[model samples]
Every structure is written in structure tokens, then in C-alpha cells.
Target: MTGTAGDVIRIAKSQVGYHEGYSGGHWTNLQKYSPAVPGLEWSQNQAWCATFAAWCFQEAGMPKGSYPVTASCALGVSWWENAGRFSDYPGIGAQVFFGSGGGSHTGLVYAYDADFIYTAEGNTNSSGSAEGDGVYLKKRARRDTYVYGYGYPSYPTGIVTADPAWKNPTAPSQQEEAVALTDDDIKKIGRQVVTGANGAKSPDDPTVEWAMSSFLGLTYKTARTIAADVAAVKAKVESLSVGGVDLDALAEKVADKLAARLAE
Candidate 1:
């Protein structure tokens, strides 16, 4: 399962077997519990929820640690809740920094009910049902600090769909790695493909893949894709031999496009 909120449905389903309701995208798995994959262990009880969520994202091939994780709910969503830039939840699939904002460590998001998200963390408090304290779901308590608000905006599959009154955190988050890009940030770049979009050449639009990820973190596969696309765009532009499309200028154009979108 991937770490995306989109994957939350499948991951929840895989573990719970069946769900019958949706409170604005909240899938209540039939309360069944399954161990997270081996690479990551959600086999515990009290906190395995976040671990389970981490595994989903890990499997999805997202960066191992992009903050705003479950554990950091208090800190909102950020690359490093410990480092500040706090109070932003991008979307599902992010590593939440839990505990009173700057209090505890990190965890992952698994599922959510209307007002809160269920975390799958390696709870130090308890282990699993096996040990009499198996991994379980805990709905978060919100803090206005924005630290523990919503999903991190920068997940590989994070898309900014309309925010519903339902679900915990209540909104998408804002977190980044080397660079910061927003849902709107991606759309502007897409518009720049004006001259080439309808044409086959535009399929190779430099920002397409990232746009598809909604400008969130790059997945392992997407990272390769980004690198390739960068090379290809450079090559294709260079091959055009069109004096008008300066390589640097093209980059600026793309940046401008993204900047414009971000402003919106």
C-alpha cells in the first residue's frame, strides 16, 4: 500500500477486510488489525497505527521521512517538526510529528473518522494485542497551533481535493524537502505547456509527473522519473536548437509558471 490518503482506503481495507461507510472519505475498517509489512512493523497495539501508515507510504516508495507525521500532530506538518516551520498538514502519506507540537517523536497516519485521524505509531506506551497491547487506532485531538492540524501537502500522491468539513486535521498541510511546492504551485506549471500540451511533445512536460504527485514529495519511482524528465526536457529543448528557447530561460519560465500557481 502507498502512503497516500488515496492509499488509506486500500491499506485500511487490507487490514480491516471490509468497510461500509464514508464520513467524507473516512473509511472505518471493521476494526480488524493486521501487521504492517516486514520492512516496517505495525505489529504492535497502542501505536502500531502510525507504523502501519508509515509502511504504506514506505511501500508507496515515498521518502522515508517527510514530517508532519502522526506523532507530531501537535506540530502540524513540516519537514522537521523539531526544526520548526510547523503547523501544516499537506495530506495523507506524511510522517506526522506527534505530541504537544514540539513534544514527542514521529508517527504515520493510518485512518481517520470525521474529526480525527487514526495513527499507526510504534507506541512506547503499549505493544500489541499479542502482548496484550496490540497496535490500535487513536483519534487525534486538535490543537490550533496548526502543528497537528491536517495532512502534509507534499505527499507523492497528495492531491488538493476540496476540504470537507469531515475528517481530522480539517485541511491539507504544508511541508517540503529541498524545495517547497504546493497543489496550486503545480497547476501553474501545467498551464505553461500551452504551446505543446495538445501536441504529443507536451506529454513530456517537465512538471507532469510532479504535477501528478500534486507537487508533494517524490516517490522512489517518481524520483527517477523526475531526473529523467529533467534530462529529457534539457535535451529536447537543446535539440530544438531554437535560439529563442534559452535553456536558462526555459527553466525560468517553468519557475515562473510554478510561482504564479503558488501565488494562487
Candidate 2:
């Protein structure tokens, strides 16, 4: 599986303040995305908005050579279109492209509504121009000039199982990291349980995929396909609804069952 949209957004959000400058730090960092151009020089003149987007995909675990590392917004759009993922409206995490100086500019879609869209863009600033000075979040109306179509990356929707070759025995389960489950988390997990019980399959449902992978140690595919696994998930959901079962105990039981299934 490829990186999640969550992974892309998290990585992009980490670089919000990056700026083009004489110091060359941002330039050198973005250069890592384009290793094929050996000994590339750092330059403020170089347009890096697209490179920044590609780098986020890379850092989010997009396989090398699967995505093109280009500085051209048009090229990025071309790739997504060729893959049949281009669309007129922007989706969350879609790559928003714009025309600039006979070329193009781009950013990641953060959110949108009927009137406007918000973005996390690099090499831009408060004014939101494509050729602005640094990385900054910007908002624009939907009908803004130069608003080219979006390039949607094919983010994985299933629980991304670790490769057996790369799985780390020491990694902690998602429940271990939470310490305490919030009402929202429990409700969300319960929804996933109901979905599985009903035998629903949504390759684009990130929340359930996350819960299945992180809390239950099951992939979306595995949880939905295996009857016993679905029954276990449904039982937990019923326990949550009835309000007497110990969540911690149920979590452990589900995890153990899921881990056994994974072994099969």
C-alpha cells in the first residue's frame, strides 16, 4: 500500500515556515527529492513549490520511482491525469495546480467549501502568489484566476500492512500509544465495527482503515473478508454499546485474535 492522505498532510504541515533564502537550507532540503539531477545547486531562483509537494509524498513513504520528482506543476498534473486521478474539483490532499508566468504553480489541498479553498503551499507567503517567498498556508476563492484542476495522488485506503521483510517486532500498537481512549475514538471504532459486521467495504474510508490497522492489528481487507474477524469486531461494538464490558480487556482480546489471524 502507498502512503495515507494523513501521512501526506502530516509531513506537509511539518514544513509550514520553510522559506527561500540566501542561507540555502530550504533549497538543500528540497533537493533530496531530485537526486537524479546530480550535484544540483541551491538557488532562490528555482521554483520549489512542486518539489515540496513531491517531497511530502516521498517522506510519507511513496515508493521511489513510483512518483516523478519534478519542479513543474504541469508535469505533476500530467502524471496524475495519466494515472486517471485528475479531477476538476479539489479533494482533501489533492494537488492544486495553478498557471504562473506561462508555467504553473501548485500546493496541497487543505480544505474547501462552496466559496473557497485553503492550501498549504511552499515558496509562497501571505499574498498567496505562486512566486512568493516561503512556505505558508493560504486560502483562495474557488473561482480565483489561475486555478487549474487538481492532481489527486492515489493514496492507499486499506490498512497498510507492514511488509514482512520490514516489520519491526518492537513497534507498539495504536492503543498502547493512546493510553486512554477518548469518547470520539471509541465512537469511531464502534462505527468501524458496525461497518465490518455489515460487511461493508470502503477503500476510501480512512477512519475505519486506521482503527482496523492500529487498534485491531487487522487490515481492512482482512477484517472484512474473514467471518471470524468480523464477528470479533461486532462483539466489541456490542460491548461498547451495552456499556458494561471493559474496553481495555476487549482491546487486548481483539488484538490477540487479530494477531492470530495475521499469522494465518
Candidate 3:
């Protein structure tokens, strides 16, 4: 928020240039996917865009985690229900929120044309690969499409606030925007599956947690949880046989889980 829109674009360009895209799987892939290259040493997968935004701020020498509720600023349509940034205007560095519900995909408000918004996102697409299909940019249509809204920061606003721009009545579906909460939250429910664990650490299998967490945005403590989960997946991948891991089935599982949680 301190710098101009051009500054944000420059930083984003630098970050995007730093990596060679990879299949974005096993949440920990980002660890090597980001830093090993160059500009994105801190680029990570989090529970949502806000947390990813927080990580970017930390990496780029911006104040991070200073405001708890302001994380919503990372979305497209910021409610600013909390006293944070982005609750006021739609700027280059604000968070973009879409849809309405339990979880929404968050992204850095990178660049914009007269009729569209160009975004820098980490965890989108079906391949779930790192570097994001090797193309460092994605665009959200602004005018006639389902743009929902825009947001900016007003107060001590480190996040974004809302701006009503589009006229489309059909908001994106919650499933279109939903990602899991953070790893810790999901592990809390996975506790029912643990059998052999002592009080040493959480017995919840880390692979599922990491997959789900990375599917979300890499939050703080939850980010590390994803790392451990990825480790578990890699550790067991050779031993596990290939089976009915169909993507549509996987998507259905994700949708069902999100639906159940949102309902709750």
C-alpha cells in the first residue's frame, strides 16, 4: 500500500520471473518451487490468498501479520468487517475476493486493463503444478463477466476494502472460490482417523492434510503443516500403488468437503 501500482507490478514481475513452473502437488513443492529459483524465495502455498499475501509481504520486507482480521483484504470484494486495509479501495496491491461463503480464492490485485484485471496467483488450475502452468499471469474479466466486485484499504488498512463495480447478478459459486481452511483446522477433524500416535505430535496423516492445505492457501503455522504432509506423501509415494485417484473424483471430494463445512 505504501508504493505505487507500478511498484507492485514490478515486484510481481520480478517474482514471476524467478521460477520454472512445476506440477503444483505435494504442498511442499512450493518450498523448492519458489526460493530455489530467484525472486520468490518466500512465495508459498497458504490457506488462502490473504495468507499468501501475508507471506509475500514478509518476503518483500512489508510488515506482516500486523492485523489479524485484515486478511480479508486479500480477496476481491473485501467486506472490511474487520478494521484493516483494502476495506476501502481497489488498488494494485489489494486482495481480491470473489463469491460468497466459507472460503474464496485470494489473489494479489496485480495489473488491470480498462476491462479486465490481471492477477498473480499461486494455486489455481487443475494440474496443481507449481509455477502455475508455466504462465505467470491470469486475467479476470472486469466488465461483462462475473467480476463480483473490487476493494481497497482505508484505515490502518493493510488489506483491501470493497468497491462495487460489476453489474453481473450471478456471483461465482462457493465451490468456484472455496479452498480448505488451514492445515491445523483440517487436522482437527482428521483426528478421528489417527490410531498409533502418542502425544508426541498430531497423528493425523500429513499427506491428506498437505494436499488439502495446499489446495487452500498456505497460512502460517498451517503452511509448515503442509510441508510435513508433503514429506509424508513423497515418503510413501513409491510404496503406494496407483489406483482410482481420478481427478473428477478428487474434485467431487473437495466439493463435498467444502459443501459440508460451509453448511456447518
Candidate 4:
């Protein structure tokens, strides 16, 4: 049978506590086993986050070249992007990239929520730095600047993503047929709507922030940060009363405007 995302995840989870050699200059079980797979033999003592991810795919029976086999996280990102398999949203078994230019560290995403992402990363420690020792399960804030994006594997069962363009193969009818939005489009739209709201200020209400975050698939922190001036304008908006106008109704109108902008 063909390997699945679950298979890769299971194999990665099983190696959670595995660490590098005590005094061997980053030596690892992965390095010891790298010779088994041709072209993967050079990862002996160097950074092994990508190496570990490649090994998990290998052990799970995924075909070679389906995923990038390199020690460099940046190369992994380029592989998926060039293949059109990169996404801003996290998916199970997706490779999560970190640091500047997404070249610092890499990990496999096991799960994600509105606010955080959980990962199975190798060459990381409890603090979750990209360069560390051992395999670890890490919980990270989704809005973390270090989190650049995700690289998807072409699993036999198909990949699921929050990107509207990359529809979940398992649930075709449930997805709307819409133009795929590039990563730039989504980020641009998200910033425009959030910043444009309340005239260059973000709406400070949690409800508004949550709604915008959900609609854009952006983290709550990102939404809030984008509209950093929300608090300064909140009191002004709340205190204004013109001809008995309902502020709640005005907020609803603002929300409608946001939706309209998003649809544009």
C-alpha cells in the first residue's frame, strides 16, 4: 500500500525523544542510517531537521523526490513552492519552515489550532530553537514571525489545506469553486481589510479580531498586530453619537464593508 500522511506522522511521533550523540558533534541515529538511502549519506553530523523529515517519509514508504531530501530548510521550501505544493496554512504531515527566509529550521506539522501549531521536529530542543539537539514535539504560536510557511507532501490520499485554491480531494462538494489566491493575495487582503477598518486602526474587539482572523486564515495575533492602532481609536468610536445612531449597528456595517472588500 502507498504511504499516507498518517504513516509519516506516526513514524515521526515514535522518534520524539531520540537525541543526538553526547559528544560526537551532532551525530544522530539518522546519520547512522542515512547510508541506507543513496544521496542521503551526507547528513551525518550537520543539521538534521530536514534529514529527519526525509527519513520519516522514507520509512513510511513515500516515494523519493515526492519530498525534498536535503539538510537545508530553505531548499525544502523551494522544492514545495516550485511544485505548487506550498501553502500558508498548516496541514497534517506538512513540513513547517522557520526563521529568516524560511532557511533556519524545519519540522513536520502534526496539528494546528486557531492560535498555535504543533510540530514533530528533529534537531530542536525544549525551547524549540531551529538549531538544537534531539527530536521534540513543539507547540508554537501560529503568528510567530519565525514561522514562514508550510510545505505539503503529495500524499496518495490527497492534501488538505486552508488555501481556497488547494481544495481537499476528499471533500470536493463542500468546497466552493473559486479562484486560487496566491500567498501574496491573502496577506495583502488581510492587511488591507484589518488596517482599513476604523480608518487606519484595527478594531480592538476580540470578536472582530477573531472573525477577521478566521476569515483570512491568519492567526489572531497577526490580525491584532496588523491593526496595532485599534486601542487608540476604540474610545473615540465608542464615544461618538450622531443623531442617535446605534454603535452596534455601525460595527455591523463595518463588518459588511470588510466582507465586501474581501470579496473584491
Candidate 5:
């Protein structure tokens, strides 16, 4: 599995109960971290569902070609429409838009069923109105008139979970590494590895081979060969320069770290 869908949903699920504070202080802080929306004098009272969506995509390490980060729902819609990714079918990590004629609110789709679509929305609450207190995970009918389609982001394959909601965090390791890798190192390694797999270049991406050696703490050719052997056991990597190398697990290993890096 490419794991991109799982990665995006995991990040969004991490922020389920987040709410905006008085005068929108909380939402403003979310906006501050998003580089895409700038210069405008942002007020706590301003609409921020779009801001949250953009920030989540940014945090997911999704490239603009796959996901556009923007504050205006209309603008966000335009971006997906331009990319030809807008569609009626809601898939994991697809941006579910609401309203009609133009658009109103937007959110990241978490889970869905024939009758309803589960969502993680910002500037909304239990009442499910666009103008609300903060971020929430809500359920809306699939046939709800407010539904305006979606922005479908491409994913690698395996990350999507059967569970309908985000799971709790995993326990931290009590045993530390001999040399602990910094967040930056993890993120860099992840980006290099993912881009190597998912980038336009495909199997030619060097980091696939490079990361395995690094993860094994090996710097020699033999180590990479062994790594390729281990990877090849998992998936078909029969062609290209690294004839026997595989990347399915490599991408999953780096997904969470790469996601954290995007948040940074």
C-alpha cells in the first residue's frame, strides 16, 4: 500500500475535539501555522473551516498537485476543479464540500457509509452549522442537500483503516535509540523516501535504497543488497535500476515521521 490515504486520515484524526477559543484565538493560532493564507488581518471571529482543511493537507505532506491548501472554500473548490480531482464519490482523505450554487463549508472525510458520511470539520460543532465553535467529527447524510461533492487526493494504497474514527495515540518507547534521530532527520528521510516512491520519477528514486541502508545503520553496498532482498520479499520490484528493491514498507515506515515534519 502507498499509505498516503492512511497518513492523511491519521493526522486529521489526531485533532478531533479541537475547538476555537473566545474571539477565535484558537482558530487564529491554526491560521498562523498555515503559510498559504497570509497578509490578511485574521480575526478569531473569521471563518476558519477552510483554514483547518488547508493546515491538515499541509501537515499530511501532500504535494499541491495532490492537495491544495487554501482558506476560501470557493478557492479550494476552484483548485480541485482545475486539477480535475473533484468528484461525487467520497474516498478517505477526500475534502467533502458543502452548500450549493457556490460552496459553503468544507471538511476532511474520515469515514463513510451508504447512508452517511463521517467528517472532521472546522468552525463547526455538534449542531453541524458552518458558523460554530470549533473542529468536530460529525456525521451527515450522503444525500444531504448541502453536499457539493469532493476534492479527491491520490493515495498510495494501505493507510486507510476500517475503523470509522481516529484512534488514540500509541505509547512512546521507553527504550531510547543509541543515537536518537531528531524530528528533522526523520522528516527529511521520510520526504526523500516518499518522493522517491511517489514522485514522477517512480522506482528510480534513490532514497528507497538509501533509506533502507540508513535505517539498518549500514553504509555499504552489501547492506543495501540485503535490504533490497528483504524488501523484495514484500512486493514486486522486478524492474528499473534497483531491479529487486521494493518500497511498499519503506513508504509506510516513513509516513508518520514525514507527516510530523510537515506539521513542523
Candidate 6:
């Protein structure tokens, strides 16, 4: 199953106390995360703040292309920026980048308030150094100089970001919007329905049908009855022409006006 922002936070929270192991006369970053990402094994024992963020996203079931998987914080920022998913505001489960140009360190943002942002980071200690020891949760000021920005992941469910220009990821497509009818438009459509100009003998447009059925609460039988009534009225109006006025045109205009009122 696809995971949510909450899942990413939970997985990162579960690794709060993980520390690197010592091997081969060095602090070998012999951790479970390095091998999980391709081309990241070489970063073992190096700064792994970005690696930790990548692992959290991976374990949370975020598909490879949906989120960045890298060891360099700068590269991660570039990845999000290139995809137009980078933001200055914080979001839950977003990858938080820190330091100069967002290259020095990285972490996962679990929460944020007006004044502070909370994070789950690896290779950090009480001092909050870029290259420190184990996984730790830290709180930093929202306007801290080291805090650069955020990299939002395109979760399968959706993405909620503070940027107004960015729309909801799962919103209906443009094709769906095209079928949305206004009251005036619906009244015009009603005239077509009554006149059989909407191809009553052929397969109806699904969108038009849905608009009539769902919005106007019209059924097939109800539409046929309306057509019959209109035809009868038009026939009666044609026979009652006064002076030189075109009664047929007058009747059609009156029917259109009545249809508009009825739609309301």
C-alpha cells in the first residue's frame, strides 16, 4: 500500500537512537540505509543526513521517482527544485535542507509551528552539528540562518503545501472541468434537449447526460414529456399568428425564456 506523510514521520521517529558502528579502523556507516539506495554505498561513513531522509521516504513506500534518493543535501535540493516541488514553507514529512545553499545537512520535518520546525535527523547530536553521531529529533527556529527550505514529495495520496501557486495533486483533471455547466448553460442545453438537437436518437454525450440527470434531476421519461409539451405549445402558437408578426419565432423565443426560468 502507498504510505502517507504520517508513515514517513513514524518510520523516522522509530530510528531516533540509531548510531553508526565502528569497523576497519574508522567510523564505518555500516547502516541499513546506505545499501537501500543505489550509488549510495560509497557514502558510508560520510555525512548521512540526506541518506537518512532518503531511507525514511523509501521505507514509507514512496516510489523511487516520487522522492529524491541521494547522499548529498545539495543534490537533493536540486532534485526537488528541478521537479518544481521545492518550497520555502515547511510541510509535514517534507525533506528539510540546512546550511549554506541547503547543502550541509538534511532531515525530515515532522512538525512545525509559527516559530519553530521540528525534525528527525541522522548524524546529529545535542549541538546539532552537520556531521555528528546518531539519529535525533531536533527543534530549530523557523527563521534560523542554517534552515534553507523544504523538498516536498509527491505522495500517491496527495501533497499539502503552503505555496498557493501549487494546486492539490489529486484534483480533477481539465477534462472534468470542461463539462461543468453554469445555470445559463444548462438552460441552453434544456432547449436543445426539448428540440432534439442534442441527438436524442443517438448515444448522448455522457457529460451532458450527467449534467441533466444529476444537476437538473431529469430522467429519460421526464425529458420526453418536456419535448412533447414544447411541440404541442409550438403547434398551437403557429396557428395563432397575430397581424404580420412571426408567431413561430415568437413562440421559440418565449420557450427559451421559460426554459431559462425553469432551470433556476
In order, what lDDT does every prediction score? 0.44, 0.69, 0.45, 0.79, 0.67, 0.81
Better of 3 and 5 by TM-score: 5
lDDT of 2 by residue, 105-209 (tens): 888877788778888888777888777767788888877777877766665552222112322135465778879889988877676675686466753466566
Candidate topping TM-score: 6
Ranking by lDDT: 6, 4, 2, 5, 3, 1
Tens digit of per-residue lDDT, candidate 4, span 108-177: 9888888899999988899987777788999999888989999989898786555567765464443455
> What stretches of model 5 exceed 4 Å from their correct place?
1-3, 23-45, 158-264
Model 6, runs deviating above 4 Å: 22-28, 172-192, 195-264
When 3 and 4 are scored with lDDT, the better candidate is: 4
Q: Model 1 over residues 223-249: C-alpha lDDT tens digits?
A: 676567567766877776576656776
Candidate 1 TM-score, true structure as reference = 0.33
Q: What's model 1's lDDT at 100?
A: 56
> What's the count of clashing pairs in each model shown?
55, 0, 40, 0, 3, 0
Which one is best on lDDT?
A: 6
Clashes of 5: 3
Candidate 5 global lDDT: 0.67
Candidate achieving higher TM-score, 5 or 6: 6
Report the number of backbone clashes for model 3. 40
Candidate 1: segments with Cα more than 4 A from true spot: 1-3, 12-53, 63-78, 81-90, 105-107, 110-115, 118-132, 144-153, 160-264
**lDDT per residue, candidate 3, 72-152, as tens digits?**
433323343343333323456654555443135555677665667776654454342222332245677655333444444
Cα lDDT tens digits for candidate 5, 66-97: 66656678888888889766777666788889
Report lDDT (Cα) of residue 13, candidate 1. 34
